[model samples]
Structures are given as structure tokens and as C-alpha cells.
Target chain A: MDLFEYQGKEQLRKFEVPVPEGRVATTADEAAEAARGLGGRVVVKAQVQVGGRGKAGGIKLASSPDEAKDVAGQILGMDIKGHTVKRVLVERAGDIVSEYYVAFLLDRSERNYLGMMSAKGGVDIEEVAETDPDAIARVHIDPLLGISDFHARKLVFGAGIEPRARKGAIAMIPKLYNAFVGLDASLVEVNPLILTGDDRVVALDAKVTLDESAEYRHPTFAELKSAHEVPEQERLAKEKGLNFIKLDGDVGIIGNGAGLVMSTLDVVKAAGGEPANFLDVGGGAGAELLSNALEVITSDKGVKAVLVNIFGGITRCDLVAEGIIDAFDRLNMQVPVVVRLDGTNAEQGRKMLQEAPNERLIPAETMLGAAEKAVELAHGGGA
Target chain B: MSILIGTDTKLVVQGLTGREGSFHGKRNRDYGTDLVAGVTPGKSGEDVDGVPIFDTVAEAVAETGANTSMVFVPPRFGADAILESADAGIEVIIAITENIPAMDMARTVNYIRTRGNGTSLIGPNCPGVISPGKANVGIIPGEICEPGPVGLVSRSGTLTYQIVHELTQRGIGQSTCVGIGGDPIPGSNFIDILEKFEADPDTDMVALVGEIGGDAEERAAEFVKEKMTKPVVAYIAGVTAPPGKRMGHAGAIISGSKGTAEAKMEALGAAGIRVGRNPTEVAEIVQELRG
Candidate 1:
């Protein structure tokens, strides 16, 4: 789960990492009040998960409370890369001598934690990686040993940090590492870890992605989930305990596993229909879960047809078939559903589906055939 | 003739008294795997359908000479379960527990690697290993698989079943099918299984099932190009997956410009491996290669 900039900063502060004192505001009046509290000079940053916020004109420097209010008003409703600005971070403006980048993330290939630092910061790191690879210094930290003083020194020296800011950077790296591990974060990036004129190292921008599976340990993270920030379908899916992602298309897909759901989406696309969403009913889909899934799918007005693809292993196809029939009895589903049952007890499941009274339920022999049928139905062809 | 498990695999199950553990354990035994013993702390001497349970892995291994372990513990104690098995010197550990914290896996994986016991760990969220008609270690349905020359490896459970069903329909059987799980940090990778397949005498061509996430597929392609002599056909899912969304699997997400199906397919295709646009196409390529 990605954290908004204000939340990330709050997390950083909890770990003793220095960040500019900031206040989160939803309205222009709140922004003005926050700016006044910060001595009348502030930076109004649009709080969105996506990047390139500054380029999208969602960030601005305010010289006074009035300017802060004006800037916050302009940014609150602006869209940056499809994410609407719902809130703004009003932070005290800083005088930066130089900009640097520092981050700690799971290096999936190495199966270890990776620390990256660069003397050059604030611009796109990937572009820097493409243009000047040597500017970024990467170190793989052992998950067992964690980040030591030696690792921090290596990163500082390798990145060629200026002598004036070396101590501050060195002191700050380990704190960030603590936040990364302590918070169960997949990524903790402080881009433009700025060197203030007074020689203090402060994180200007925080990008933290927490591991959702580790949410069991961090109960406080639940408070950070702003309901307004989530889309309605996604919020509903979460409430129903379904793993779902809303997509743009006509055919709604429901499958057993992540890979199978993704493959279903692709197959639907290949058969000339776009998928409306990716929904995984998980390993065991009972009657109640199936009905809940159908209700969620039909909630989207764009979904013209539904595809239920199940290759049961732990998930019994016969049980799934019963659930689908049960769902038809409970919900007033308008869309035609193309169901493909395979793996465990698939024959019996298909037989049950064939015998069901619902005329809108269509059973196909193969995954490809089922996808084609769903595509045809979605495109207004005969069921 | 299988790469991971065969008739020689003496199996022990962890968390054997639990719901998933008992179910899959009994199914595996019914499929003719040599179910020697089970380990459920405090439930020692108990039996799940005549399979005796030991309190710890060491006792189970000592009594039954169980060399392979199937883990069905919950997410919280999953790392401890794997560590216990490794400590007991289990030669092969296939973990079927999903949602194990990545940090826990990281530490467990590191500890296992640093120990250098040559213990092969397959998954923390996978559908075990099956050597058709020989031995079933984890939860891969033994019925769909037929013993043949083809080796299969995938990052999914049900998707693996889909591809295997396609192969069975086409009369293209498998020597072994391994699901390496869809977590960000699985114990075994495509290259690990592919190298084993390359060395195995019974296996002929290989079918790789990958999805959007990490650079595992891209790295596997490089490994195939450099080392393997076996023919490989690939199918990468999530071609239509949008960016910044987790597609069911925790690891299956498009992060920035990396971990896209298009990129993985390109890498695999560039390595002389036939890239399938869909699962059926993958089976067709495997059939053609086998012929």
C-alpha cells in the first residue's frame, strides 16, 4: 500500500528522520491556517500517489498565507496522471544547498535489501540510471545483518557526497533503514534528501510503500487509509474480502488465482474484448462469496459480460458450480456469464451448470473458447 | 525421472493436523506418495488416517527417514516451519503456505543460503511438486498429469493446472510440474528448475509459465541463452495488466516501466525461446517442439 507524502513524512518522523514540519489540509482555508502556523512561508504540494506532480503544476511555493491558500485551492482538484488531488501538504519552505537521493528497498532478484544513494537528486532516477549509471551507488545489505556503519559509509563515499554533508547523510541513512525494516515497508525513498543551508539533512519528499501482508503487525497503518482516496469499486471489494482491481473494458473477469486472473484478462483481450476488472475469488469460492463477487462486478455499469474461469485444485469445481447457481438465485444479475470449469471435479461441476435453470449462465469446454464466448456476448452477439 | 521428487521421496508434512495440511497430506498419500510421518508440535503420536504425527521435524526424520517436507503452516509461523525443516536436514522443502511476510522469507532464505546445506526450498505460496504417477509431494492434482518427456515450471497454481490440462488434451505429457509460487521472493526460481531439467535425462523440452513481476523471467531468459541446451517455450501472463495495480498475486504488479509482460516476452523471444501469446499457444509450441 502506497502512502501519501504527508503520511510518509509522518512515518519518517516516527523513525527520527528529520523532515520539514508539515500539516495536511483538505481545503484552501486549512492550507492558509497551516501556512500561518508555519510562519507564513510554505510549499503547497498536492498529495497524490503518482509522480511528476511538480510537472503537472500540482506543487507551488507560497510566500504568504494568502498565496498558500490560492496555491492549495488550485492544486486540491487538479489531476496528475489520473490521480485526483484530494489533499495538500503545507510544509515550511526550506533553503537547499544541494539535493541527494537515498532509498532502501527489497531487491527481489537478489532476495535481499538494497540501498541506493546518488549525489544527483530531485529528477527522475530511472533517467539518471539510463543516462549516467555511475551516478547512483547501490549496495546490497544482508537481510540478517542489516545496514551497518560500514554500509552507510560505503554508500556516502561511493555516491561522492560533499564533505560538508557527509556526516548528516551518514547519520540519516541508518534511520531510514530502520524505518524501512521497522515499518515493514517494501520501499522507503527520500528523493531530494536535501542539505539545508544550516547544514541539516532533511527528507524533502517521502515515498513509502508498505507491505500489506505485514499489516497484521502494524495496526496503526489502518488509520492512514483515507476512504476518500480509494475508488468505490475497490473499497467495496476490500469490504467483501475479494482481491480485485478495477480495469477499463466490457467483460468482467473472475478467476481462482492471480496468474489465472491475469491470464483471463489477457485471453479476453486477445479474443477482442477488453476486461473490466481483475477479481480473484481465491482458492475456495462458496455460495456467499460467489454472490458477493457477482454483485461487485455488476456494480460497474461498463461490464457488459462476465467470465468465471476456475481451474480448481484446492478449489473444488463442483462447489464453485453450486456457488454460481446459488449466486444466480440471490442476485438480480443482468450480464451474461461465461463459465469455464476445469481441474478437480470439473465434469460434475459442468454437469451441474448444464442442469441449472439460469439461462444466462453459459458453460464452455476450454479457456480460449470461454474467453471467445464472453467477448462475443460482451460485443452484443448471441449468447 | 522427475527433477525434484520421485519414488525415492520420503515425505513428512508440517502442520499436519491443521485443515489444509490434513487435507492435502491425505490426498498426496492417496496419490501413492510415500507418506512416512507428520509433524505437529504437541500433537505427537497422533495420526491423521494412520500417518503418525511427531512433535518436531527431527523426530519425524529420525523415525521415518523422511527426506522431503511439505509445509502447510499458517503465514505467521511459516518461516519457523521452514527453518525447523531445514534444521532437521530435510533435503527438499516445498512450502504451500501463502501470505508469509516477505521479511520473514528473506531472513529464512538468507539463513538457509548461509547454512549451505544444499536444501532445495520450492515455495512459500505454491502448489507443491508432482512427478506424474511416481510421487506427489505438495498439492498439484496428480490426476491431470501424465508421465512424459516435458518439464513444466510456473509461478501460479491454477494457471499451471490450466497449461497442464492443455498439454494433457494435446497428448503432451509432463515429466514434472513445479509451481515456484507467486511471492516476490520464492525459494526456487525458473532458472533453478530449468537447470535441473536440462540435466535430467527423462525431460525433453520445457514449458515456462511466467507473469508480470520482478525480472525473474528476464533473468531466466539470460540463463537459458547462456547455459541450457533444452528447448523452452514461454507464456507470460498480464499482457493487458495496467500499471500500479497488484493483479491478484502479491508479486504480480507492474512497477514503473519494469516487470511488464511485453518486456518478459521480448527477452524470452530474443533468447531463441518460442514465446506463446496465450496458454494454448504455449501448449501448441511445446507439442511442435516435442515432435
Candidate 2:
């Protein structure tokens, strides 16, 4: 899950990284009050989880609390790349002598954590690596040994940054690395590590993506949920403990595994139908879980038909069929339903569904057949 | 005759006393796999599904002479379980546990490589590998597959089954089908399985099922272009997936155009391979190759 800019700074502060004094404000008055507390001068930045905030005029420098309020009024609620800015971060303006870049991220190809630091800052690091690769010093830390002073010094010398920033680079680079490791974060980037007049390097901005699977470990990460960013159906799915991603089509898909769900989506499209969403009931999904998955999918207004494609492995098709039957009883589902059951206990499951014979349900013999039926039903096709 | 597992595969399951472990363990045995022993800490001297349970992999390996390990443990200790099996001299470990923190996987991957004794891992989050009509390892349905000559490798579970069933229905049975798992850092990669499929006499052609995310598919395409002689048909999923959103698979996210489905598809097409638009199309390509 990607944290908002302010939340990223808060996480970095937890790692004892020095960040400029800041407060989150939802309104112009709150922005003024926050700026007043920060020497009556602040930087009003939008608290959306997207890039190019400055280019979009979501960031503004104010000389006084009055100016801060005006800037906040303009930036707040502004849509930046489809993300609505509900809050603004009012931070004390830092005295910047120079800007540097640093980040620690999981490298999928390398199968290791990569540490990247560059003397050029306040821009996309990928662009820098593209335009001038030598400017960015990239290092791969051994997963077992982790980062140390030697690695820090290597980045310091390789990036060709100024000498005074070297001390902070040595101290701060590993601290950022620790944050990445300690938090089980996939990525932690400080784009502009600014050097102040007092010879101190502080993080001016932060972008952190915590591993969602590691949410079981860090309970406090719950508060950083981007509820506004996630749609209502997705919010409901998360609450129901289902892996569901809402789409823009008419066919609601429910499958046992992620890959199966994805394939079901493709097959729906291949059958001349668009998928409403991708929903995986996950392993060992019983009647209640499948019912919850069905409820979540049916709740979407765009869903004209629902396809339950389950390839039982650890999950039994009989149990899944029972769940669908039970769910049909509990919920008022208006959409045309297509059920395809295969794998373990499939014959029993198919027999059970056939015996009940709900009018809303259409049982197909094969995966492709099921997709075709669902698609035909979705596009105003006959029963 | 198969690359990873065959009639000689004596399997010991880790976390055997657990619900999933006991369930799939019995399923593996029911499919005619040589069920050997099980490892469940502190549950030694007990029996799960008539299989002897040992407290450690060392004891299980010592008693059962099992060459392979199927891990179905919780994510928290999943890496440790894999390390234990590797340390105990299990050659191929198929980890079925998902949500193992990526860092833990990175560490185990490096550890296995540095301290290599021919230890190979398939997945910490895969469907395991199946040699049709010979042995069943993880959770792939053993009934749907037919023993023949087509070699299948994929990064998904149910999609692997779907494609294999498509191939089987079209009279194109497979020698072995391997789901290398959907994790970003899988234990075995496309090249590893492709190399095996190329060398195995029982296998004649190959089907590569991939998804957007990571450079594994692109790298595999390069490998196929350079070294492989077998006719390879490929299918990449998540073609309609949004740029930033991860669709189901943890490794199935499009990373800034680097791991897009189009990129993987183009690379495979440029490598003189038939890239299918869907699973059925891929089966057709394999059918034509069979001719």
C-alpha cells in the first residue's frame, strides 16, 4: 500500500530521520494556523499519492500565514491525476543549499534490495539514470549481511555529491535502508535530501510503499489506509476479507485463485463480454467466504451477470456450490448467474447445483462454455 | 523422464499436521505419488494420513530417504522451513506458502545459492510441478492431465490447469507441467524449466504461460531465441490490467512499461514464437506444433 506524502514523512520520522516541522490541514484556516506555528512561513503541498505535484501547481511557497491560507485554498480539493486532494501538508520551508536523491527498494530481477543515491535531486530518478547513468550510484545489498558503512561510502563516492553531504549520506542512507527493512517496505524514497545552512541533510519529501501482506505484523499501519483513494466496492471487499478489484464491465467474476480469476476475466472478454471486476475467493474458501464474494460482486451496479469459475484444489467445489446456493437465498441478486465447477468433488458439486435449479443460475459444462454463457447473458443475450 | 518429479520422487511434506498440509498430502498420495514421511515440529512419532511424522526435516530425510520437499507452512516460518529442508539435503523444495515477506525470500534465495548443494526450489507461492500420469507434487489436479510429449511451464496455478486441460482436450497431452509460482522472486524461473523441457526426451514442444510484471518473461524469451530448438508457444495474461494496479498476482503489476504484457508479448513474438491472445489460442499453437 502506497502511503501519502505526509504519512510517508511521518513514517520516516519514526525512523528518527529529520523532517521539517509539518502539520496536515484539511482547510484554509487550519493551514493558516499550521503555518503560524511554523514561523508564519510554510510550503503548502497536496497530500495525494501521485507524482508531479509541483508541475500541477499542487505545491506552493507562502511567506505568511495569510498567503499560506490562500495557497491552501487553491491546492486543497484540487484533482491531481484523478486523485482528489482532501488535505494539504503545511510544512516549514527549509533553507536548501543543494538537493540529493536516495531510495531503497526491492529489485525483482536482481532478487535483492537496491540502494540508489544520486547528486541530482527533485526529479524522476529513472530519467536521471536514463539521461546520465553515472550520476546515480546504485548498490545491491546482500540480503543476509544488509547495508553498512562500506556500502554507504561506495554510494557517497559513486554519486559524486559534495563533501559536506557525505557525512549525512553515510549516516542517513543506512537509516533509510533500515526503515525499508524494518517496515517490510517494498519502496522508500526521499527525492530531495536537502542540505541546510547549518550543514544538516534532511528529507524534504518521502514516498513509501509498505508491503500489504506484512499488515499482519504492523497493526499501526491500519491508520494509513487510503480509504478515499479506494472505491466503495473495494472498501467493502477489503472489509469482507476478499481479494476483489472492481472493473468497468458487466460480467462479475469469482474464482478460487488470482490467476484463475484473471484468466476468467480474459475469457469473458474473449467471449465478447467485458469483465466487471477481478475477485479471487482465495484458498480454502468455504460457503460463507464465497457468499461474501458473491455479495460483493453483485453489489456493483454495473454487474449485469455473475460468473463463478472455481477450479477446486484445496478448495472443494461442493463447498463453493453450497456457498453460492446459500448466498442466492440470503441476497437479492438480480443479475444472471453462470456457474462452472471443476476439480475435486466437481461431480457432486454440479449435481447439487443442478438439483436445486435456481432460475437465476445457468450451469455450464466447461470453462469456455461458462464464459460464453456469461458473456451471452451479459450482452442482452437469451437464456 | 520428467524434469523435476517422476516415479522416483519420494515426497516428504513439511507442516504435515496442519490442515492444508494433511489435505494436499493425502491428495498427492491418492494420485499415486510415493508418499514417504512428514515433518511437523513437536508432532514426531505421530501419523498424518498414515504417513510417519518427524519433528524435523533431518529426521524425515534420514528415515524416508525423500529427495523432494513440499512446504505448506504458515508464511511467518515458511522461509525457515524451506531453509531447514534445504539444509537437510532435499534437492527440490516446492514451497506452497504465500505472503512470505519478500526480504525473507531474498535471503533464502541468496543463502541457497551461496551454500549450494544442488538445492532447487520451485515456489514459496506456486501450484508445484506435476509430471502427468507419473507423480503429483503440490496442488495441481492430477486427473485432468494426460501423460504425453508437450512440456508446460507457467507462473500461475489455475491458469496452468486451464491451459493444460485445453491442451489435453485437444489431444495434446503433456509430459510435465510446472507452475513456477506468481511471486516476484520465484525459486525457479522460466529459463530453468525451459532448459529442462528442451533436454527431456519425453517432451517435444513447450508452452510458456506468463503475466505482466518483472523481466522473467522477457529474459525467458531471449533464452528461447538463442538456445532453444523446441517450438515454444507462449501466452501472457493481464493484458487489460491497469498500469499501476496489481491484478491478483503480487508479481503481476505493470512497472512503468518495463513489465507490460505488450512488452513480453513482443519479445516472445520477435523470438520466433507463437504468442497466443488467450489460453485456447495457445493450445491451438501447441496443436499445430504437434503436427
Worst 10 residues of 2 chain B by lDDT: B253-262
Summarize candidate 1's per-residue lDDT along A1-383 as a digit string, tens digits. Answer: 88888999999999999999999999999999999999857999999888889999999999999999999999999989988888999999999999999999988899999999999999888888888999999999999998899899999999999999999999999999999999988999999899999999999999998887887889877877652367789889989989988888989998988889999999999999999999998886765777788889989989999999999888888888888887788877878999999988899999999999889999999899999999999999998
Candidate 2 lDDT for residue A97 = 97
Clashing pairs in 1: none
CAPRI quality level assigned to candidate 2 from its DockQ score: medium
Q: Number of the top candidate by TM-score?
A: 1
List of clashing residue pairs for candidate 2: none
* lDDT per residue (tens digit) for residues B1-291 in model 2: 988999999999998899889888998999999989999889899998689999999999999899999999999898999999999999989999999888789889889978967788999799998998889999998888999999999999988888888888898888999999988778888998899899999999999999988989889999999999989999998877777878877898886657888899999999998998888889988887777
Regions of candidate 2 where Cα sits further than 4 Å from its true position: A129-135, A162-164, A197-199, A226-230
Question: What is the overall TM-score of model 2 with all chains considered together?
Answer: 0.95
Local accuracy of candidate 2 as per-residue lDDT tens digits, A1-383 = 88888888888888888788899999999999999998856899999888898999999999999999999999998999988899999999978999999999888877788898999998888788779988999899998999888998888899988998889778888888888998889999999989888889899999998887778788867888733467888989988889988788999999988877877888788788999998998877888999999999988888999999988877889999899898889997888889999887899989989887688877888888899999999988887
**lDDT for position A227 in model 1:** 29
